[model samples]
Target: MEIKDWITLVVPIIATFLTALIGFGVTLNKIKREFKYTIKSYLYQDIKKLYRDLYVCLEKVILDPMLAFEDRYIDELLNFKPDIYLFSSKNLIYCYRDFGTYLFNINEAFKHYKIEIDYEDYDYDDNGNVVGVNFGEDEVQEYQFKVSTYKEENCPSSKELKEKVENILDNLKKELNMV
Candidate 1:
């Protein structure tokens, strides 16, 4: 072929190749951004829920230390520990560890110092007649002393748990660029 003819054929081929390459790159970048957004949304939701639950648990325990030994609290800790390790940043993981350790100590302290009281309820008939007395089925009251040497010695303050949870959430926000 003549030089002009060859040049004409090569130029179009090169232009088409460059166009396709640029288009592919743009599409790939968009996919990457979308994937990152989806992951971030999931992480944000899950971690927020986890932190909220943890905060509520801490508040309850601060009010009544015996609540630390509830089955729901135990299950939440067991289930979320692995998730925290897997999905949290290094700083977040460390904060969670501090928080979890404090709660564990509180649980242990309650195991030793919690007080339970069994009480009875009376079912009265009309005309002020005594009918029946029902014994403890779900009539048990549980509490912990406000001034306990064991709790003062063993468990960290509830204020500490609040701070740790705040730290973890702050780290998560920084990671996701929501700060």
Candidate 2:
């Protein structure tokens, strides 16, 4: 083939190759951005839910000291501990650590005042076998289980802890751009 003919063929081939490469690059970039956005959205949703639950539990404890002894409130804190450790950002992690420490101190201070109530029950099968035990209204027993009064000065006020939690949550909201 003549030089001019060869040039014509080679230039079109190069142009087509360049067009395909640019198209592929643009598509990859778009996918990357979409993936990032999806991950951020998921993390934001999870963090928001967990934060709200923890805050509510803390608020209950602050509003009513007796509620602090409830098993459910303690369970909420325990459940949140691992998730916060795993998924929280650096600042949130620090806040979680501080709040956890404060909660531990409060619990320790209240240890003497802990109370336990026991209920007696019997569950029998047709053959009179004790298959299970039910703690119901049939029999009830109450005891001053581990009851001891602590000096008021020994325990930290729940209000202070609540304030710290609120501050942390506010900072978290800002960090997550939810505010």
Candidate 3:
């Protein structure tokens, strides 16, 4: 009815609306922060798993005495490429490139070695008496093989790549405030 009465009603309504709006904004912000943290955690875990897979493949290819070709290693490495490219940042992409280069160089070095097999002839007496064995030079044959006498000095060490991945994980943890 009067101005003072109208003012009183309008002030309480405005204050109530403002309080509700502020409360909703705070709740929304909290939800956003939680969502962001969850997403980051998932991403960090995925990246770590990818790095582990790559590391295992490289180690097997570089250290295994029986590994003939790098086909399996290359396949394992390439499996993570799309994920790295799509979900990772620039720094991670660079690290992946460095890892890929190391693998390529190791594979190339392994290609240079060849496998040679030698046959031996044994002499026997008429009474089945054992004599000596002869390994003539002519009995040896060399064939191109995928195996490598890979010395540790020939390729990048796993420690170096591991440190790089750990550094990336550390950075991610810092960014997410998980550390």
lDDT for each residue of candidate 2 in 1-179, tens digit (9 for 90 to 100):
89999999999999999999999999999999999999989988888888788778667767766544445666677788888778777787788778767666666556544422222245678998877865544333223322323424444467776787787777678766778
Higher-TM-score candidate of 1 and 2:
2
Off by over 4 Å in 3: 65-68, 88-92, 105-179
Q: Scored by Cα lDDT, where does model 2 land?
A: 0.69
Q: What is the TM-score of candidate 2?
A: 0.69
Output the number of the TM-score-best candidate.
2
Instruction: Report per-prediction Cα RMSD to one decimal.
Output: 9.1, 8.1, 10.2
Candidate 2: 10-residue stretch with minimal lDDT: 139-148
- lDDT of each model, Cα atoms only? 0.66, 0.69, 0.61
Candidate 3, 1-179: lDDT as tens digits: 99999999999999999999999999999999999999988987877777556556545644552332465765677787897688667776777676666666656655543221211245667997758655455433212211222443364555665665565555445434568
Q: What is the RMSD of candidate 3?
A: 10.2
Measured against the true structure, the TM-scores of the candidates, in listed sequence, are 0.56, 0.69, 0.56
Between 1 and 2, whose lDDT is larger? 2
What pairs collide in candidate 3?
none
